[model samples]
Target: MDPYLLNAPWVNTLRLVLEVAATVAFALSGVMAAARKRLDAVGVCVVAFVAAFGGGTLRDLLLDQRPFFWIRHTEFVWGILALCIGAMLFMRQRHFEPTERAMLLPDAIGLGLFAAVGVDIATAIGMPPIISVMMGVTTGVFGGVLRDVLCNEVPQAFSDHRPYALCAFAGGWADVALRQVQAPDWAPLVACVVLTAGLRGLAVWRNWELPAWRV
Candidate 1:
Protein backbone atom coordinates (compact mmCIF):
# COMPACT_ATOMS: atom_id res chain seq x y z
CA MET A 1 0.00 0.00 0.00
CA ASP A 2 1.32 3.43 -0.87
CA PRO A 3 1.44 5.35 2.38
CA TYR A 4 1.06 8.67 0.61
CA LEU A 5 -2.26 7.71 -0.98
CA LEU A 6 -3.97 6.95 2.32
CA ASN A 7 -2.43 9.99 3.92
CA ALA A 8 -3.87 12.51 1.47
CA PRO A 9 -6.05 15.20 3.07
CA TRP A 10 -9.09 14.36 0.96
CA VAL A 11 -8.73 10.68 1.79
CA ASN A 12 -8.66 11.59 5.45
CA THR A 13 -11.84 13.60 4.92
CA LEU A 14 -13.45 10.63 3.24
CA ARG A 15 -12.54 8.38 6.15
CA LEU A 16 -14.02 10.83 8.61
CA VAL A 17 -17.18 11.01 6.56
CA LEU A 18 -17.42 7.22 6.50
CA GLU A 19 -16.99 7.04 10.27
CA VAL A 20 -19.70 9.62 10.91
CA ALA A 21 -22.11 7.90 8.56
CA ALA A 22 -21.40 4.51 10.17
CA THR A 23 -21.99 5.94 13.61
CA VAL A 24 -25.38 7.31 12.61
CA ALA A 25 -26.38 4.13 10.83
CA PHE A 26 -25.57 1.92 13.81
CA ALA A 27 -27.20 4.35 16.17
CA LEU A 28 -30.41 4.10 14.16
CA SER A 29 -30.25 0.32 14.30
CA GLY A 30 -29.95 0.48 18.07
CA VAL A 31 -32.94 2.78 18.25
CA MET A 32 -35.03 0.36 16.28
CA ALA A 33 -33.99 -2.53 18.53
CA ALA A 34 -34.85 -0.58 21.64
CA ALA A 35 -38.17 0.39 20.19
CA ARG A 36 -38.94 -3.19 19.23
CA LYS A 37 -38.31 -4.15 22.82
CA ARG A 38 -40.67 -1.39 24.01
CA LEU A 39 -37.98 0.11 26.15
CA ASP A 40 -38.18 3.46 27.92
CA ALA A 41 -36.37 6.62 26.85
CA VAL A 42 -33.28 5.92 28.88
CA GLY A 43 -33.04 2.37 27.56
CA VAL A 44 -33.29 3.68 24.03
CA CYS A 45 -30.49 6.14 24.55
CA VAL A 46 -28.25 3.57 26.22
CA VAL A 47 -28.68 1.05 23.44
CA ALA A 48 -28.08 3.70 20.79
CA PHE A 49 -24.85 4.78 22.44
CA VAL A 50 -23.61 1.22 22.73
CA ALA A 51 -24.43 0.34 19.16
CA ALA A 52 -22.86 3.57 17.89
CA PHE A 53 -19.60 3.40 19.83
CA GLY A 54 -19.04 -0.17 20.99
CA GLY A 55 -17.11 -1.58 18.01
CA GLY A 56 -14.88 1.43 17.45
CA THR A 57 -14.19 1.62 21.16
CA LEU A 58 -13.03 -1.98 21.19
CA ARG A 59 -10.87 -1.39 18.14
CA ASP A 60 -9.22 1.64 19.73
CA LEU A 61 -8.51 -0.34 22.87
CA LEU A 62 -6.89 -3.17 20.96
CA LEU A 63 -4.87 -0.76 18.83
CA ASP A 64 -3.61 0.91 22.00
CA GLN A 65 -4.69 4.27 20.68
CA ARG A 66 -5.02 7.14 23.06
CA PRO A 67 -8.37 8.91 23.47
CA PHE A 68 -11.06 6.67 22.12
CA PHE A 69 -12.56 7.95 18.87
CA TRP A 70 -15.74 9.19 20.45
CA ILE A 71 -13.74 10.89 23.18
CA ARG A 72 -11.66 12.63 20.61
CA HIS A 73 -14.85 13.63 18.83
CA THR A 74 -17.23 14.53 21.61
CA GLU A 75 -19.74 15.69 19.03
CA PHE A 76 -20.47 12.05 18.30
CA VAL A 77 -21.87 11.74 21.79
CA TRP A 78 -24.20 14.66 21.28
CA GLY A 79 -25.18 13.50 17.81
CA ILE A 80 -26.25 10.05 19.01
CA LEU A 81 -28.15 11.57 21.90
CA ALA A 82 -29.98 13.83 19.49
CA LEU A 83 -30.60 10.97 17.13
CA CYS A 84 -32.09 8.89 19.92
CA ILE A 85 -34.46 11.63 20.99
CA GLY A 86 -35.51 12.40 17.45
CA ALA A 87 -35.99 8.77 16.49
CA MET A 88 -38.05 8.07 19.59
CA LEU A 89 -40.33 11.02 19.02
CA PHE A 90 -40.72 10.32 15.33
CA MET A 91 -41.49 6.68 15.86
CA ARG A 92 -44.00 7.36 18.57
CA GLN A 93 -45.79 10.13 16.69
CA ARG A 94 -45.96 8.14 13.48
CA HIS A 95 -47.05 4.93 15.21
CA PHE A 96 -44.13 3.24 13.50
CA GLU A 97 -43.56 -0.36 14.39
CA PRO A 98 -39.88 -0.91 14.92
CA THR A 99 -39.73 -4.41 13.57
CA GLU A 100 -36.59 -6.52 13.14
CA ARG A 101 -36.88 -6.13 9.39
CA ALA A 102 -36.87 -2.37 9.78
CA MET A 103 -33.52 -2.50 11.51
CA LEU A 104 -31.70 -4.52 8.84
CA LEU A 105 -31.06 -1.73 6.38
CA PRO A 106 -29.26 0.58 8.76
CA ASP A 107 -27.38 -2.33 10.27
CA ALA A 108 -26.12 -3.44 6.87
CA ILE A 109 -25.11 0.09 5.90
CA GLY A 110 -23.24 0.62 9.14
CA LEU A 111 -21.48 -2.69 8.67
CA GLY A 112 -20.16 -1.64 5.28
CA LEU A 113 -19.12 1.86 6.24
CA PHE A 114 -17.45 0.72 9.42
CA ALA A 115 -15.67 -2.09 7.63
CA ALA A 116 -14.22 0.31 5.08
CA VAL A 117 -13.15 2.78 7.72
CA GLY A 118 -11.54 0.05 9.76
CA VAL A 119 -9.54 -1.37 6.86
CA ASP A 120 -8.37 2.07 5.79
CA ILE A 121 -7.26 3.00 9.28
CA ALA A 122 -5.49 -0.30 9.86
CA THR A 123 -3.74 -0.17 6.52
CA ALA A 124 -2.67 3.43 7.13
CA ILE A 125 -1.09 2.29 10.39
CA GLY A 126 1.02 -0.27 8.45
CA MET A 127 -0.77 -3.32 9.84
CA PRO A 128 -0.55 -6.55 7.85
CA PRO A 129 -3.38 -7.39 5.48
CA ILE A 130 -4.79 -10.17 7.67
CA ILE A 131 -4.80 -7.92 10.70
CA SER A 132 -6.40 -5.13 8.69
CA VAL A 133 -9.12 -7.46 7.54
CA MET A 134 -9.78 -8.62 11.07
CA MET A 135 -9.94 -5.04 12.25
CA GLY A 136 -12.50 -4.32 9.56
CA VAL A 137 -14.62 -7.26 10.62
CA THR A 138 -14.39 -6.28 14.26
CA THR A 139 -15.33 -2.69 13.60
CA GLY A 140 -18.21 -3.78 11.44
CA VAL A 141 -19.72 -6.55 13.57
CA PHE A 142 -18.84 -6.14 17.23
CA GLY A 143 -21.14 -3.23 17.97
CA GLY A 144 -24.18 -5.15 16.78
CA VAL A 145 -22.98 -8.05 18.91
CA LEU A 146 -22.83 -5.79 21.92
CA ARG A 147 -26.25 -4.39 21.06
CA ASP A 148 -27.91 -7.81 20.94
CA VAL A 149 -26.22 -8.80 24.20
CA LEU A 150 -27.52 -5.64 25.80
CA CYS A 151 -30.98 -6.39 24.40
CA ASN A 152 -30.81 -9.83 26.06
CA GLU A 153 -30.84 -11.88 22.87
CA VAL A 154 -28.22 -13.96 21.14
CA PRO A 155 -26.43 -11.73 18.66
CA GLN A 156 -27.99 -11.94 15.24
CA ALA A 157 -24.52 -11.99 13.74
CA PHE A 158 -24.02 -15.38 15.37
CA SER A 159 -27.60 -16.64 15.40
CA ASP A 160 -29.28 -15.28 12.28
CA HIS A 161 -27.27 -17.61 10.04
CA ARG A 162 -27.22 -14.98 7.36
CA PRO A 163 -24.20 -13.56 5.54
CA TYR A 164 -23.62 -10.64 7.89
CA ALA A 165 -20.03 -10.83 9.06
CA LEU A 166 -19.09 -12.73 5.95
CA CYS A 167 -19.99 -9.70 3.88
CA ALA A 168 -17.62 -7.60 5.92
CA PHE A 169 -14.89 -10.20 5.61
CA ALA A 170 -15.18 -10.27 1.84
CA GLY A 171 -15.30 -6.49 1.63
CA GLY A 172 -12.23 -6.22 3.85
CA TRP A 173 -10.32 -8.44 1.48
CA ALA A 174 -11.51 -6.34 -1.42
CA ASP A 175 -10.18 -3.23 0.28
CA VAL A 176 -6.84 -4.86 0.91
CA ALA A 177 -6.57 -6.14 -2.64
CA LEU A 178 -7.36 -2.77 -4.14
CA ARG A 179 -4.74 -1.08 -2.00
CA GLN A 180 -2.21 -3.71 -2.94
CA VAL A 181 -2.79 -2.97 -6.63
CA GLN A 182 -2.57 0.77 -6.11
CA ALA A 183 -6.15 1.49 -7.07
CA PRO A 184 -7.31 5.08 -6.67
CA ASP A 185 -7.16 6.19 -3.06
CA TRP A 186 -10.94 6.33 -2.76
CA ALA A 187 -11.64 3.16 -4.69
CA PRO A 188 -11.00 0.78 -1.84
CA LEU A 189 -13.36 2.54 0.50
CA VAL A 190 -16.11 2.79 -2.09
CA ALA A 191 -15.70 -0.79 -3.20
CA CYS A 192 -15.69 -2.06 0.34
CA VAL A 193 -18.88 -0.22 1.24
CA VAL A 194 -20.76 -1.12 -1.92
CA LEU A 195 -19.80 -4.77 -2.02
CA THR A 196 -20.32 -5.39 1.68
CA ALA A 197 -23.65 -3.59 1.90
CA GLY A 198 -24.88 -5.00 -1.41
CA LEU A 199 -24.12 -8.55 -0.38
CA ARG A 200 -25.78 -8.13 2.97
CA GLY A 201 -28.85 -6.52 1.47
CA LEU A 202 -29.11 -9.27 -1.10
CA ALA A 203 -28.79 -11.95 1.54
CA VAL A 204 -31.57 -10.44 3.60
CA TRP A 205 -33.82 -9.98 0.61
CA ARG A 206 -33.23 -13.51 -0.66
CA ASN A 207 -33.45 -15.10 2.79
CA TRP A 208 -30.04 -16.67 2.33
CA GLU A 209 -28.58 -18.49 5.31
CA LEU A 210 -25.46 -20.29 6.33
CA PRO A 211 -25.76 -23.93 7.41
CA ALA A 212 -26.39 -24.31 11.05
CA TRP A 213 -24.42 -26.83 13.09
CA ARG A 214 -26.08 -30.17 13.66
CA VAL A 215 -25.99 -31.56 17.16
Candidate 2:
Protein backbone atom coordinates (compact mmCIF):
# COMPACT_ATOMS: atom_id res chain seq x y z
CA MET A 1 0.00 0.00 0.00
CA ASP A 2 1.26 3.49 -0.78
CA PRO A 3 2.23 5.60 2.19
CA TYR A 4 0.16 8.40 0.74
CA LEU A 5 -2.84 6.13 0.80
CA LEU A 6 -1.94 4.99 4.31
CA ASN A 7 -2.24 8.58 5.47
CA ALA A 8 -5.62 8.86 3.82
CA PRO A 9 -7.98 9.66 6.68
CA TRP A 10 -6.19 12.77 7.91
CA VAL A 11 -5.12 13.82 4.44
CA ASN A 12 -8.64 13.47 3.20
CA THR A 13 -9.88 15.69 5.99
CA LEU A 14 -7.34 18.35 5.12
CA ARG A 15 -8.30 18.08 1.47
CA LEU A 16 -11.94 18.64 2.32
CA VAL A 17 -11.14 21.73 4.37
CA LEU A 18 -8.90 23.13 1.67
CA GLU A 19 -11.51 22.43 -0.98
CA VAL A 20 -14.15 24.35 0.93
CA ALA A 21 -11.86 27.30 1.46
CA ALA A 22 -10.88 27.34 -2.20
CA THR A 23 -14.49 27.08 -3.29
CA VAL A 24 -15.59 29.99 -1.13
CA ALA A 25 -12.75 32.20 -2.21
CA PHE A 26 -13.31 31.49 -5.88
CA ALA A 27 -17.04 31.90 -5.48
CA LEU A 28 -16.53 35.33 -3.98
CA SER A 29 -14.26 36.27 -6.86
CA GLY A 30 -16.88 35.24 -9.35
CA VAL A 31 -19.57 37.11 -7.49
CA MET A 32 -17.45 40.22 -7.39
CA ALA A 33 -16.87 39.99 -11.11
CA ALA A 34 -20.51 39.43 -11.80
CA ALA A 35 -21.46 42.33 -9.61
CA ARG A 36 -19.00 44.55 -11.41
CA LYS A 37 -20.60 43.53 -14.69
CA ARG A 38 -24.05 44.32 -13.29
CA LEU A 39 -25.22 40.78 -13.84
CA ASP A 40 -28.62 39.67 -12.61
CA ALA A 41 -29.17 37.20 -9.78
CA VAL A 42 -29.25 34.13 -11.97
CA GLY A 43 -26.15 35.26 -13.84
CA VAL A 44 -24.35 35.77 -10.55
CA CYS A 45 -25.21 32.24 -9.47
CA VAL A 46 -24.06 30.78 -12.77
CA VAL A 47 -20.70 32.55 -12.63
CA ALA A 48 -20.20 31.63 -8.97
CA PHE A 49 -20.93 27.97 -9.64
CA VAL A 50 -18.53 27.82 -12.56
CA ALA A 51 -15.76 29.59 -10.66
CA ALA A 52 -16.21 27.32 -7.65
CA PHE A 53 -16.28 23.97 -9.44
CA GLY A 54 -14.73 24.38 -12.89
CA GLY A 55 -11.18 23.48 -11.98
CA GLY A 56 -12.02 20.60 -9.69
CA THR A 57 -14.36 19.20 -12.29
CA LEU A 58 -11.63 19.24 -14.91
CA ARG A 59 -9.13 17.78 -12.48
CA ASP A 60 -11.39 14.89 -11.52
CA LEU A 61 -12.15 14.15 -15.15
CA LEU A 62 -8.46 14.00 -15.99
CA LEU A 63 -7.83 11.75 -13.01
CA ASP A 64 -10.79 9.57 -13.90
CA GLN A 65 -12.39 10.12 -10.51
CA ARG A 66 -16.11 9.37 -10.53
CA PRO A 67 -18.84 11.69 -9.27
CA PHE A 68 -16.82 14.89 -9.25
CA PHE A 69 -16.22 16.51 -5.91
CA TRP A 70 -19.06 19.02 -6.21
CA ILE A 71 -21.49 16.26 -7.22
CA ARG A 72 -20.48 14.04 -4.31
CA HIS A 73 -20.68 16.95 -1.90
CA THR A 74 -24.02 18.38 -2.96
CA GLU A 75 -23.98 20.60 0.09
CA PHE A 76 -21.25 22.62 -1.60
CA VAL A 77 -23.77 23.71 -4.20
CA TRP A 78 -26.18 24.93 -1.54
CA GLY A 79 -23.37 26.63 0.30
CA ILE A 80 -22.42 28.54 -2.81
CA LEU A 81 -26.01 29.49 -3.44
CA ALA A 82 -26.41 30.84 0.10
CA LEU A 83 -23.11 32.64 -0.15
CA CYS A 84 -24.12 34.38 -3.39
CA ILE A 85 -27.44 35.46 -1.98
CA GLY A 86 -25.93 36.83 1.20
CA ALA A 87 -23.08 38.62 -0.56
CA MET A 88 -25.39 40.26 -3.06
CA LEU A 89 -27.71 41.43 -0.34
CA PHE A 90 -24.82 42.89 1.66
CA MET A 91 -23.28 44.61 -1.33
CA ARG A 92 -26.58 46.14 -2.33
CA GLN A 93 -27.25 47.36 1.20
CA ARG A 94 -23.85 49.04 1.31
CA HIS A 95 -23.96 50.25 -2.31
CA PHE A 96 -20.61 48.59 -2.77
CA GLU A 97 -18.89 48.65 -6.11
CA PRO A 98 -16.81 45.60 -6.91
CA THR A 99 -13.51 46.53 -8.46
CA GLU A 100 -10.93 44.48 -10.30
CA ARG A 101 -8.26 45.27 -7.76
CA ALA A 102 -10.57 44.20 -4.96
CA MET A 103 -10.88 40.74 -6.44
CA LEU A 104 -7.14 39.97 -6.29
CA LEU A 105 -6.83 38.81 -2.71
CA PRO A 106 -9.56 36.19 -2.72
CA ASP A 107 -8.53 35.02 -6.17
CA ALA A 108 -4.96 34.62 -5.03
CA ILE A 109 -6.05 32.74 -1.94
CA GLY A 110 -8.20 30.39 -3.93
CA LEU A 111 -5.37 29.78 -6.37
CA GLY A 112 -3.03 28.77 -3.58
CA LEU A 113 -5.47 26.50 -1.81
CA PHE A 114 -6.65 24.76 -4.94
CA ALA A 115 -3.07 24.35 -6.13
CA ALA A 116 -2.17 22.57 -2.90
CA VAL A 117 -5.24 20.37 -3.09
CA GLY A 118 -4.45 19.47 -6.68
CA VAL A 119 -0.91 18.43 -5.81
CA ASP A 120 -2.19 16.37 -2.88
CA ILE A 121 -4.76 14.53 -4.97
CA ALA A 122 -2.36 13.76 -7.80
CA THR A 123 0.34 12.58 -5.42
CA ALA A 124 -2.07 10.29 -3.62
CA ILE A 125 -3.07 8.81 -6.94
CA GLY A 126 0.58 7.87 -7.59
CA MET A 127 1.20 10.33 -10.37
CA PRO A 128 4.75 11.40 -11.20
CA PRO A 129 6.08 14.55 -9.53
CA ILE A 130 6.12 16.55 -12.76
CA ILE A 131 2.58 15.56 -13.52
CA SER A 132 1.48 16.46 -10.01
CA VAL A 133 2.97 19.90 -10.40
CA MET A 134 1.17 20.39 -13.69
CA MET A 135 -2.05 19.28 -12.08
CA GLY A 136 -1.49 21.83 -9.34
CA VAL A 137 -1.07 24.63 -11.89
CA THR A 138 -4.11 23.47 -13.79
CA THR A 139 -6.30 23.34 -10.72
CA GLY A 140 -5.10 26.73 -9.59
CA VAL A 141 -5.75 28.58 -12.84
CA PHE A 142 -8.47 26.77 -14.78
CA GLY A 143 -11.40 28.14 -12.80
CA GLY A 144 -10.12 31.68 -13.08
CA VAL A 145 -9.69 31.11 -16.80
CA LEU A 146 -13.25 29.90 -17.15
CA ARG A 147 -14.55 32.78 -15.11
CA ASP A 148 -12.64 35.36 -17.13
CA VAL A 149 -13.57 33.87 -20.47
CA LEU A 150 -17.21 33.80 -19.49
CA CYS A 151 -16.91 37.49 -18.60
CA ASN A 152 -15.39 38.10 -22.04
CA GLU A 153 -11.99 38.96 -20.70
CA VAL A 154 -8.60 37.38 -21.24
CA PRO A 155 -7.73 34.95 -18.49
CA GLN A 156 -5.27 36.29 -15.95
CA ALA A 157 -3.14 33.18 -16.29
CA PHE A 158 -2.60 34.02 -19.93
CA SER A 159 -2.57 37.80 -19.94
CA ASP A 160 -1.49 39.08 -16.52
CA HIS A 161 1.59 36.83 -16.50
CA ARG A 162 2.54 37.90 -13.04
CA PRO A 163 3.89 34.50 -12.09
CA TYR A 164 0.48 32.91 -11.58
CA ALA A 165 1.01 29.37 -12.80
CA LEU A 166 4.70 29.72 -12.04
CA CYS A 167 3.87 30.18 -8.39
CA ALA A 168 1.75 27.05 -8.39
CA PHE A 169 4.50 25.12 -10.16
CA ALA A 170 7.05 26.12 -7.55
CA GLY A 171 4.74 25.40 -4.66
CA GLY A 172 3.77 22.03 -6.04
CA TRP A 173 7.42 21.02 -6.39
CA ALA A 174 7.97 22.15 -2.81
CA ASP A 175 5.13 19.95 -1.64
CA VAL A 176 6.51 17.00 -3.56
CA ALA A 177 9.97 17.57 -2.12
CA LEU A 178 8.67 17.78 1.45
CA ARG A 179 6.72 14.57 1.00
CA GLN A 180 9.78 12.81 -0.38
CA VAL A 181 11.70 13.82 2.74
CA GLN A 182 9.09 12.22 5.03
CA ALA A 183 7.68 15.49 6.26
CA PRO A 184 4.28 15.34 7.93
CA ASP A 185 1.49 15.09 5.37
CA TRP A 186 -0.03 18.39 6.42
CA ALA A 187 3.26 20.22 6.17
CA PRO A 188 3.39 20.01 2.38
CA LEU A 189 -0.14 21.22 2.01
CA VAL A 190 0.36 24.13 4.36
CA ALA A 191 3.72 25.04 2.90
CA CYS A 192 2.46 24.97 -0.66
CA VAL A 193 -0.57 27.07 0.22
CA VAL A 194 1.53 29.71 1.90
CA LEU A 195 4.08 29.80 -0.88
CA THR A 196 1.54 30.08 -3.66
CA ALA A 197 -0.56 32.73 -1.93
CA GLY A 198 2.41 34.69 -0.69
CA LEU A 199 3.99 34.79 -4.11
CA ARG A 200 0.76 35.85 -5.69
CA GLY A 201 0.19 38.59 -3.15
CA LEU A 202 3.73 39.83 -3.57
CA ALA A 203 3.33 39.85 -7.31
CA VAL A 204 0.27 42.02 -7.04
CA TRP A 205 1.69 44.32 -4.41
CA ARG A 206 4.92 44.94 -6.27
CA ASN A 207 3.32 45.18 -9.71
CA TRP A 208 5.39 42.25 -10.85
CA GLU A 209 4.85 41.17 -14.42
CA LEU A 210 6.44 38.87 -16.91
CA PRO A 211 8.18 40.79 -19.68
CA ALA A 212 5.84 41.28 -22.57
CA TRP A 213 6.87 39.77 -25.87
CA ARG A 214 6.87 42.23 -28.73
CA VAL A 215 6.62 41.18 -32.31
Candidate 3:
Protein backbone atom coordinates (compact mmCIF):
# COMPACT_ATOMS: atom_id res chain seq x y z
CA MET A 1 0.00 0.00 0.00
CA ASP A 2 1.22 3.47 -0.82
CA PRO A 3 2.13 5.45 2.25
CA TYR A 4 0.30 8.46 0.88
CA LEU A 5 -2.90 6.48 0.99
CA LEU A 6 -2.88 6.75 4.73
CA ASN A 7 -3.74 10.40 4.41
CA ALA A 8 -6.25 9.98 1.62
CA PRO A 9 -9.72 11.39 2.13
CA TRP A 10 -11.35 7.97 2.42
CA VAL A 11 -8.97 7.06 5.20
CA ASN A 12 -9.89 10.21 7.04
CA THR A 13 -13.55 9.42 6.52
CA LEU A 14 -13.05 5.95 7.95
CA ARG A 15 -11.30 7.37 10.96
CA LEU A 16 -14.21 9.71 11.55
CA VAL A 17 -16.62 6.81 11.32
CA LEU A 18 -14.62 4.79 13.81
CA GLU A 19 -14.45 7.69 16.20
CA VAL A 20 -18.18 8.21 15.99
CA ALA A 21 -18.88 4.54 16.61
CA ALA A 22 -16.48 4.42 19.54
CA THR A 23 -18.07 7.53 21.03
CA VAL A 24 -21.49 5.97 20.83
CA ALA A 25 -20.22 2.76 22.39
CA PHE A 26 -18.62 4.48 25.38
CA ALA A 27 -21.58 6.81 25.80
CA LEU A 28 -23.87 3.82 26.07
CA SER A 29 -21.55 2.30 28.64
CA GLY A 30 -21.77 5.52 30.65
CA VAL A 31 -25.53 5.59 30.34
CA MET A 32 -25.71 2.06 31.71
CA ALA A 33 -23.38 2.94 34.58
CA ALA A 34 -25.37 6.04 35.49
CA ALA A 35 -28.62 4.16 35.31
CA ARG A 36 -27.23 1.43 37.54
CA LYS A 37 -26.37 4.13 40.04
CA ARG A 38 -29.86 5.59 39.65
CA LEU A 39 -28.59 8.99 38.57
CA ASP A 40 -30.99 11.61 37.21
CA ALA A 41 -31.08 12.79 33.61
CA VAL A 42 -28.48 15.50 34.05
CA GLY A 43 -26.16 13.08 35.75
CA VAL A 44 -26.75 10.59 33.00
CA CYS A 45 -25.88 13.16 30.35
CA VAL A 46 -22.74 14.22 32.13
CA VAL A 47 -21.47 10.68 32.62
CA ALA A 48 -22.24 9.75 29.05
CA PHE A 49 -20.37 12.74 27.71
CA VAL A 50 -17.42 12.02 29.94
CA ALA A 51 -17.21 8.40 28.91
CA ALA A 52 -17.58 9.30 25.26
CA PHE A 53 -15.01 12.07 25.12
CA GLY A 54 -12.67 11.52 28.04
CA GLY A 55 -10.06 9.39 26.30
CA GLY A 56 -10.10 11.18 22.99
CA THR A 57 -9.90 14.57 24.70
CA LEU A 58 -6.85 13.49 26.65
CA ARG A 59 -5.30 12.10 23.49
CA ASP A 60 -5.79 15.40 21.71
CA LEU A 61 -4.24 17.34 24.57
CA LEU A 62 -1.20 15.11 24.69
CA LEU A 63 -0.77 15.39 20.94
CA ASP A 64 -1.01 19.17 21.23
CA GLN A 65 -3.96 19.23 18.90
CA ARG A 66 -6.03 22.36 19.41
CA PRO A 67 -9.81 22.60 19.80
CA PHE A 68 -10.05 19.00 21.00
CA PHE A 69 -11.82 16.36 18.95
CA TRP A 70 -15.33 16.99 20.24
CA ILE A 71 -14.94 20.71 19.87
CA ARG A 72 -13.88 20.29 16.25
CA HIS A 73 -16.67 17.81 15.62
CA THR A 74 -19.67 19.49 17.15
CA GLU A 75 -22.12 17.01 15.72
CA PHE A 76 -20.56 14.35 17.91
CA VAL A 77 -21.60 16.43 20.91
CA TRP A 78 -25.19 16.72 19.77
CA GLY A 79 -25.29 13.08 18.79
CA ILE A 80 -24.16 11.88 22.19
CA LEU A 81 -26.70 14.08 23.91
CA ALA A 82 -29.45 12.65 21.75
CA LEU A 83 -28.14 9.15 22.37
CA CYS A 84 -28.31 9.66 26.11
CA ILE A 85 -31.91 10.77 25.93
CA GLY A 86 -32.96 8.00 23.60
CA ALA A 87 -31.08 5.33 25.52
CA MET A 88 -32.61 6.36 28.82
CA LEU A 89 -36.11 6.40 27.39
CA PHE A 90 -35.61 3.05 25.71
CA MET A 91 -34.17 1.41 28.79
CA ARG A 92 -36.98 2.69 30.94
CA GLN A 93 -39.61 1.54 28.50
CA ARG A 94 -38.04 -1.89 28.28
CA HIS A 95 -37.27 -2.15 31.99
CA PHE A 96 -33.70 -2.87 31.06
CA GLU A 97 -31.24 -3.88 33.74
CA PRO A 98 -28.08 -1.80 33.68
CA THR A 99 -25.75 -4.33 35.17
CA GLU A 100 -21.94 -4.26 35.11
CA ARG A 101 -22.06 -7.33 32.94
CA ALA A 102 -24.23 -5.49 30.48
CA MET A 103 -21.67 -2.71 30.08
CA LEU A 104 -18.69 -4.92 29.15
CA LEU A 105 -19.45 -5.42 25.47
CA PRO A 106 -19.76 -1.78 24.56
CA ASP A 107 -16.80 -0.89 26.74
CA ALA A 108 -14.68 -3.46 24.97
CA ILE A 109 -15.80 -2.16 21.61
CA GLY A 110 -14.96 1.42 22.50
CA LEU A 111 -11.59 0.35 23.80
CA GLY A 112 -10.66 -1.26 20.50
CA LEU A 113 -11.94 1.56 18.35
CA PHE A 114 -10.27 4.28 20.36
CA ALA A 115 -7.05 2.35 20.53
CA ALA A 116 -6.87 2.13 16.77
CA VAL A 117 -7.65 5.78 16.29
CA GLY A 118 -5.08 6.83 18.84
CA VAL A 119 -2.34 4.72 17.31
CA ASP A 120 -3.14 5.84 13.80
CA ILE A 121 -3.14 9.50 14.72
CA ALA A 122 0.14 9.23 16.58
CA THR A 123 1.74 7.31 13.79
CA ALA A 124 0.59 9.89 11.28
CA ILE A 125 2.33 12.53 13.34
CA GLY A 126 5.59 10.54 13.10
CA MET A 127 5.74 9.30 16.66
CA PRO A 128 7.93 6.34 17.50
CA PRO A 129 6.21 2.97 17.49
CA ILE A 130 6.32 2.54 21.26
CA ILE A 131 4.88 5.99 21.80
CA SER A 132 2.12 5.28 19.34
CA VAL A 133 1.28 2.08 21.16
CA MET A 134 1.18 3.88 24.50
CA MET A 135 -1.09 6.52 23.02
CA GLY A 136 -3.38 3.73 21.92
CA VAL A 137 -3.43 2.25 25.38
CA THR A 138 -4.09 5.65 26.89
CA THR A 139 -6.91 6.40 24.51
CA GLY A 140 -8.45 2.98 25.11
CA VAL A 141 -8.39 2.97 28.91
CA PHE A 142 -8.75 6.53 30.19
CA GLY A 143 -12.43 7.04 29.45
CA GLY A 144 -13.63 4.12 31.53
CA VAL A 145 -11.28 5.19 34.29
CA LEU A 146 -13.06 8.52 34.48
CA ARG A 147 -16.44 6.87 34.31
CA ASP A 148 -15.76 4.45 37.20
CA VAL A 149 -14.23 7.19 39.35
CA LEU A 150 -17.35 9.28 38.87
CA CYS A 151 -19.46 6.29 39.90
CA ASN A 152 -17.36 5.88 43.09
CA GLU A 153 -15.93 2.51 42.08
CA VAL A 154 -12.48 1.17 41.34
CA PRO A 155 -11.74 1.46 37.65
CA GLN A 156 -12.28 -1.99 36.22
CA ALA A 157 -9.18 -1.59 34.04
CA PHE A 158 -7.22 -1.97 37.27
CA SER A 159 -9.48 -3.99 39.54
CA ASP A 160 -11.09 -6.52 37.28
CA HIS A 161 -7.73 -8.36 36.92
CA ARG A 162 -8.79 -9.03 33.38
CA PRO A 163 -6.89 -8.03 30.23
CA TYR A 164 -8.49 -4.66 29.49
CA ALA A 165 -5.61 -2.34 28.71
CA LEU A 166 -3.54 -5.35 27.83
CA CYS A 167 -5.94 -6.10 25.01
CA ALA A 168 -5.48 -2.60 23.69
CA PHE A 169 -1.74 -2.88 24.00
CA ALA A 170 -1.63 -6.05 21.98
CA GLY A 171 -4.00 -4.64 19.43
CA GLY A 172 -1.79 -1.61 19.08
CA TRP A 173 1.16 -3.79 18.32
CA ALA A 174 -0.82 -5.72 15.77
CA ASP A 175 -1.62 -2.46 14.08
CA VAL A 176 1.96 -1.33 14.10
CA ALA A 177 3.08 -4.65 12.76
CA LEU A 178 0.64 -4.46 9.86
CA ARG A 179 1.73 -0.96 9.00
CA GLN A 180 5.34 -2.05 9.05
CA VAL A 181 4.59 -4.49 6.28
CA GLN A 182 2.63 -1.90 4.31
CA ALA A 183 -0.67 -3.65 4.66
CA PRO A 184 -3.79 -1.98 3.35
CA ASP A 185 -4.61 1.25 5.11
CA TRP A 186 -7.77 -0.12 6.63
CA ALA A 187 -6.25 -3.45 7.62
CA PRO A 188 -4.50 -2.21 10.70
CA LEU A 189 -7.59 -0.51 12.00
CA VAL A 190 -9.79 -3.54 11.45
CA ALA A 191 -7.23 -5.89 12.94
CA CYS A 192 -6.83 -3.75 15.99
CA VAL A 193 -10.56 -3.54 16.61
CA VAL A 194 -11.22 -7.25 16.09
CA LEU A 195 -8.26 -8.44 18.13
CA THR A 196 -8.84 -6.13 21.04
CA ALA A 197 -12.58 -6.70 21.29
CA GLY A 198 -12.31 -10.41 20.59
CA LEU A 199 -9.71 -10.88 23.29
CA ARG A 200 -11.82 -9.01 25.80
CA GLY A 201 -14.97 -10.96 24.97
CA LEU A 202 -13.04 -14.22 25.17
CA ALA A 203 -11.54 -13.30 28.50
CA VAL A 204 -14.99 -12.57 29.86
CA TRP A 205 -16.38 -15.80 28.50
CA ARG A 206 -13.51 -17.85 29.91
CA ASN A 207 -13.33 -15.95 33.18
CA TRP A 208 -9.66 -15.39 32.53
CA GLU A 209 -7.69 -13.37 35.02
CA LEU A 210 -4.18 -12.10 35.44
CA PRO A 211 -2.49 -13.16 38.67
CA ALA A 212 -3.09 -10.68 41.43
CA TRP A 213 -0.13 -9.19 43.29
CA ARG A 214 0.19 -10.52 46.83
CA VAL A 215 1.23 -8.38 49.72
| Candidate ordering by lDDT (highest first) | 3, 1, 2
Global CA lDDT computed for model 2: 0.86
List ranges where model 2 is wrong by over 4 Å: 1-5
**Per-prediction count of colliding residue pairs?**
0, 0, 0
For model 3, give the 10-residue run with minimal summed lDDT. 97-106
Order of the predicted models by TM-score, top scorer first: 1, 3, 2
Candidate 2 C-alpha RMSD relative to the actual structure: 2.0
TM-scores of the candidates are 0.92, 0.91, 0.91
* lDDT of every model, 2 decimals: 0.88, 0.86, 0.89
- TM-score attained by model 1: 0.92
Which residue segments of model 1 deviate by more than 4 Å? 1-3
The total number of steric clashes, by the backbone 3 Å criterion, in model 1 comes to 0
Better of 1 and 2 by TM-score: 1
Writing each residue's lDDT as its tens digit, candidate 1 over 158-189 gives 98788999999999999999989988878999
Poorest lDDT segment (10 consecutive residues) of candidate 2? 1-10
Question: Which one wins on lDDT?
Answer: 3
